[model samples]
Target: MANNPNENEQAQIIHWADMTADRIIKQKGDKGQYVLASGITPSGVVHFGNFRETITVDFVARALRARGKKVRFIFSWDDYDTFRKIPANMPKQEELKKYLFQPIVDTPDPFERDESYAAHHEKNYEAQLEKVGIEVEAIYQAKKYRKGDYKEQIKLALTKRQAIVDILNKYRAEPLEDSWMPLNIYCSKCNRDKTDHIKWDGQWEISYTCELCGHQGSENLQTTSRAKLPWRVDWPMRWVFEGVDFEPGGKDHSSDGGSYTTAQEIVKEVFGGTPPVYLQYDFVSIKGRGGKMSSSKGDLVTVNDVLNIYEPEMVRWIFASYKSNVDFAISFDLDVIKTYEDFDRQERLAYGLEEGNDKKVAMAKRVIELSQIGPMPTVCPFQPSFRHLCNVLQINDGDIKKTRVFYAKDIKNERDERRFQERSRCALHWLKNEAPDEFKFTLNRTRPALDLTKAQTDFLNNLHAFLEKEWDNLKSDKELHEKLYEVIHSVPEFEPMMGFTTLYQILISREKGPKLASFILAIGKERVLGLLRP
Candidate 1:
């Protein structure tokens, strides 16, 4: 990730989304609308790791629309996939364990909320997506399969089983058995995919014996939902079925022997549809936690988790800021302050409110264009200092109302006020939960009695007098800072560092803390005078 926020304008900037859209337009030719596709199996919670895939598609869809192309975003929920393992995060682990090998849509919700376990995760994530401004024509695989919407495709996969096997064999190090079929089935009796001895007639009927319950049954592909195609075959089949112009895959599927490679050949050779233009995306890791997260392991963060700490636009910025192939971490650590600062700087440069390298400014325009949750506001959005907000929120003891009042004058419009309120919530949440210990503290109710050095005591007396006399005249942090510096330097041989250290110790009982000037103003001059009184 060679992402330099301060990259010089002479640097050539090529946004990945624009490149992908261009490739699709060139490869597929312009049509009335482009169908962009993404999907995942709802076997476990759809954590933030999985979000990289969908948000990648969302970015390209936005880019395509930016190029005057109509775009339809389709997100398929592969709910008909089997419940290979229960997620560690879900409730009722023992209750869920029994449903293993069953289609996820057939498994009952352990929470007993939605009709099925798959629906529980699916619906929750859908709501989370809307918060981040992603809308999709959701395709539920279970319903489509049950309604026989893919009847002709199902028969086609069966008819082309040998060709599908040959395509898959090209990627397998060891050869697949000649009898391997391109399909899978849940037993009619047991409703589990623990079936063996699968045989498909030359026509529409398929028979399989349940290895679990020992029941042998045959069902017509036209009428039964028990049969489904394997992943490699199913993916390309749907690409043709939906006329997808562009789709993106994770690194796993983009490798030489991966699903996307084989599916490209299979779609052309077996189903006779051209594969969609594809981009290979990398994984997103949680900061300080190495490696990709697993929903099955229940150690992953969700979109909701990210949204808890980030404003909606900030969430959009995290993904849009980087190319899909670039691996990045979502930090909940001190790096969070830098993340907010970076976003603010980009927003400033994009609105021409600040100057920057030409390349970065150009990149900021498109990136922020994609980052927005609504239409681009004519004026720049609010760019509050997240670090300052953290300090102010602590001064107000996490009371958002009081915190909002403190920044009320800085805000000029309803949008800025809304931003203040939202970012205040994020700042407060960070301070309470994710911030470093030194970054968090409340104002001392009463002054602390410390054995002060004569030099430190002399500086504090001067500082106290300066605040008392000039507090009412100090209009901004910068002005207050300059006047306070005069008081410290005026004392003979009093080091500026010593004066700052004494002030911090007297205020927060620490040698280091937030930017001093604004922090004092945020604390109010009268309160500082009370604390400085010896």
Candidate 2:
């Protein structure tokens, strides 16, 4: 295989993120502190598509801190926004219907929790992020708005309304009407913000007639926190308020004439602030790269779902190794096992357990470095292939000790033992739920279900004797595998594959399975002898 950053190289290499951070620091002119910000609207159950933004900023923040820069990582949840549609996972859909088009903070929780609807989703979102070891200063947009933190920005946007509209119109095929206003206000009486008759009093208040409830009233700009700027304006407005040095947006927002384009223009023209350094990350899909996954469409996966089967580091590796610009999938089927195998091989090559080319090794090492959720491991732990784990787990009936002995032969240290135990738990859950039929196996407890031919019978008898004589000599799965290959190929009456198939049928009552020698070793010599003898 290819190796990265060969051991002999002396030149320093700058990672992509490091280069970007350096530029950002220079652009900001050595501000005493930099803020790395990423936010998502908690409209419903936030899915992995949402996580792309969260993890992208997280990786960049870590990269910046590694260079001795001070960074405050902030995660904002736009929970104050209205509840437009019901999420599939949330309960009380009928009860929640009444809150449609109302600010999420004003709506009651669907589950009868004391918290509002937005708070409920925020709690769930933070819990999943915790599992992945991402720590950030979580801010709720609803709370910030209600506290009147954006009052000054709201006034400025109203004053510069025409400039903001002109910038927005440049990209829109349909320009806004002359009467267009950049703000929405929650009606004082009805709580719904549906109003087209809004007129700014040119000072600290705005008059409006609620279209939904028909209550006419004026809200004080300095006192009432119900006024909110439109999304395009709000996005850039926050960029200035938070002093964000870097942030990431989804491809949908980053496209030409999209929210980002308008926001960029608004930030420069109306807000009089420079937009932050931005990275446009692509979407995640279930059908692999380029396939789109959407929360609103009910096509989604959560971080908890991914972490249920994958080790946290492996989960981080998927996002860390793949550049943010490329689309990827979080597969849950048999292919996931292959993904784990690839991660393990890359890890070995990165940590120098296996030798390879230099440049490839360096790049691989960087990936492992960034993918770490906590402190990086000092020594590479024993990595067992997910497929091998599944098979051995079946043979041992999910006994961690026997499986560890079978795979590791002996514990290398405390770290290796802990890793083995953790991996076993993840593998068992995957086998029970996600593993495909071909990967599933059940050892037969009754007599062998086979009509053995004379040649097959002869092959089995000879193999049993061969294994018994070499049992004490075989100290590892590798040695037993070589012996099994020699004996099976030596018999002309039985083809090599057919000989292995006969053993599987006798031992597992199946025509196919894991390597016969290794499976026998995991099941123990006495068990195999008793099953094969007589």
lDDT of 1 by residue, 22-45 (tens): 889999997779999999898877
Clashing pairs in 1: 9-358, 9-359
lDDT at 511 for candidate 1?
85
Q: Write model 2 residue lDDT over 226-332, tens digit each, in one string.
A: 88988999999999999888988988899898999988889988888998998888877653322566776654577877777888888888898787888877777
Error of 2 at 77 (Å): 0.7
- In terms of lDDT, model 1 sits at 0.86
Q: In model 2, how large is the Cα lDDT of residue 487?
A: 77
TM-score computed on alpha carbons, candidate 2: 0.93
Error of 1 at 306 (Å): 1.0
In order, candidate lDDTs are 0.86, 0.81
Candidate 1 lDDT trough over 10 residues, lowest sum: 1-10
